[model samples]
Target: MAVIVTGASGFIGGAIARALADRDETVYALSRTDPEIPGVNFQHWDITEAAPQAVQSLAAKATAVFHCAGISSVSADDDALYAVKVTGTRNVLDAFPKARIVHVSSTTVYSSAEPHAELWEEAGPKDPSEFTDAYSRTHALAEQLVSRIRPDAAILRPAAVYGPGETMFMPFLSKISKKGVLRLPGGGRQKLTLTHVDNVVRAALACLDVPSAAGPFNIGDPTPYRLKDAIVTHFGRMGYDQVVIEGVAKDKALVTAKLGLKVKGVFKRGDRAKLFLVQYLQSDRTYNLSRQQRVLGISTTQHLIPSRFQ
Candidate 1:
């Protein structure tokens, strides 16, 4: 039997595909570009369009399709993001109607800042239009589509995933620092949940293992880390000495950030939703993982941040 993985070129999907191959599973990796994983068959698939003929051939042999393809950039074009996240998802579902779908989703689908409250799975499905960021809105809409069409699909909503092969989390943090000072909204005191990529991989695989087990699962580390602490730990280990961490008011930071720029009379599309990052840095976003732990039997107690992110 075979299991298919979309977006094998990405960090999360690549890691998942590698793990599946390591376990001796016949892995069919679908991506426009090659993910270059050994022991896996590569298939060219453009999710926004029809699935390739090869996908249909493997439908009978395929047990699951790990839908992990989507743009995670907040600055990406809204139309491009929607095409990949929303339209692409529809195509994947249609292509693998008989296969169990293990959808890798984001926690951004929810718009909550409640303190000390663990965000339950049912707490969201917030309208996609509410999010000002491109990635969040499109991902939210894509998730909604999955829920409506395949309610029994395994939907894993992971927080800002950081770990081995991560290209987003730490890099984004690193870019925020200017000179020796790292300024964040609210002094980076807000506790944010971060799910390790390995945990997410485990959750996705568990869902594939138990095809009958479905619904949404909030995947994150056992404890939330303060923004300052996470930043300090990441930089401190990387030998980035003499860096100072500072916190400022959200409103002040918003004014300082050059969100959308204008040249001549026209405005540049250089991330019109830049303020969303500032808001997230100052918010308390955590998750409740009791259901995941109880059902998936996956505990993310260790492997918080690996030394070398491969």
Candidate 2:
């Protein structure tokens, strides 16, 4: 039997594929572009379209399907997110009816219009339509669909995933830093529950190997990190020195972001970038990971923290 990893070209998906390949698993990686992992086989896949014929044969021998073939762009058209996340999820479910579904969703689906000092394992919002961005709404729709169709399938809702090749937080930090000064909302003190790519892969693979890994699971590192500390550590790891971190009041950050959104189409992802900066830095979205620790047996990776954070 084989493992099918969608979005294998992406950060989290590629990591999952590489981990599986390293473990000598037969991996079929599907993505718009080939991830070029040494041993993983690549197949061209566009989630917007129907499942391709060339890869459909693998389903008969597929033991698991990691549905990770979507993007999380706040500026992405609502219809587009729906097509990729909601409709595309439906297609993946239909195509891999026999395989164990491990859908990789994001923590954004948790309603975050307001600040959260503490967050734990529970369904986030009853109404995703209330969300201003399509990223959360569309993902919520996908989760609802998955839970309805395959109640026993594993659903992983990871917080702002940061590591090598990440498109969100990592890029935001890099793009906004001017010389050495980096300004962030709430002084970047928002203790965000972040998932390292390694932890995410561990949770996903554990879904296949452990029976208790069913239902929706919140996966992240052992602890939450302040946004400022995360940024400093990231830059420091790259040998950056004298990086000055500044904090903008949460209200001011919100105002600036709102103003940026009013500008029309200057940068396609500008709204996404601005909104993400404020929300990630201002909101305190931390989770109680004991559920994942108990279910996934995550104790082994406690030593995975960077030496600096330790």
Candidate 3:
């Protein structure tokens, strides 16, 4: 298969690129940075910008595309987020009009509903006017644009994706583990829906082959893990010292998140802690994987804990 993978340098996108390359597929890695992987035809193209002549040329030759490029952080300003996530998606669709686009979306599109239930593929998107966070708002907008522009595009929404090459959440967890302290919101009892990087890649590949299976689908592990247990299990495998997981009040954690961002901005400059700490630590987000299984014919029950333990 000849494929074009946007954001091939990023964690999820890079994983997909590597997986496709492993299968000996002809891969066109399109992103602002080079994927630096063997057998990948790397092209420099920013999604927010117009489709460069080079990218347009590559897209013409590609059979399918994995659109995994977009802003994943809350640190980006509203303007930058909209430009990259919303406009960026529009540009990709325009550029790859012929390719079967597999869009990597997020579970954040769902609005804050009380008594958090399992989010399904059919759930409505968060109201635009109520958006306060740039990442969720822009991602939701980007999904809409994809559906509008190319309804056949397969949209895969994964939750708290973590694995090798995960620079955002994994590194944050590792850093806090090293400190021997994990200060979670609400005492870390919140159940988290985590999708392994491998499972997401698998789902994306399935989306490519599934005949006429287009639209939003949730991809996540079957087992829901708690914040504290997941952390302990993950860190233990990495040979980190025992981490003391403690939970602060949700209200206090919000205040801490606000203060943490401000203080980090003033002192640390570009810190990753300000990425999704507030929401991940505070909220309980899980998904109903029935649609994912029924549509993709792939279900992942892989635990985030180490191999030997499993």
Q: Rank the candidates by lDDT, best first.
A: 1, 3, 2
Per-prediction tally of clashes: 1, 0, 1
Query: What would the per-residue lDDT of candidate 1 be over residues 1-310, giving only the tens digit for each residue?
Result: 9999999999999999999999899999998999989998899988989877887788888888999998867777779999999999999999888888899888888883434358888877678777767788887898889989998898999988877567776667777678988777898888888887888888888886677778889998888888677766666655555367888897787665643332221644444434567667656888898978888887875443434531
- Give residue 79's error in model 1 in angstroms: 0.8
Q: Cα miss at 274, model 1 (Å)? A: 3.9
Candidate 3 displacement at residue 59 in angstroms: 3.0
- Order the candidates by TM-score, highest first — what do you get? 2, 1, 3
lDDT of 3 by residue, 36-143 (tens): 988888889989999989888776678899999976666667798898888988999999898898999888787743434687777746666666677887888888
Residue 29 in model 2: shift from native, Å?
0.7
Top candidate by TM-score: 2
Q: How close to the true structure is residue 262 of candidate 3, measured as C-alpha lDDT?
A: 71
lDDT by residue (tens digit), candidate 2, 1-310: 8999999988889999999999999999988899999999998878778888987888899999999888756677778888899989998988888789999998887776765555665656447777777788888889889988998798998887777777776666777778878777767777777787788998988987885477778888886776677767766665545468888888888877877877645765455667766765666888777878788776424323457657
Give candidate 2's whole-model lDDT.
0.79
List TM-scores for all candidates, in order: 0.91, 0.92, 0.90
Q: By how many angstroms RMSD does model 1 differ from the true structure?
A: 3.1
Where model 3 places Cα greater than 4 Å from the true spot, the runs are 113-115, 176-178, 239-241, 259-276, 305-309
lDDT of 2 at 30: 86
Misplaced by over 4 Å in model 1 are: 112-116, 238-242, 258-269, 302-310
Backbone collision tally, model 1: 1
TM-score, structure 2 vs. true: 0.92
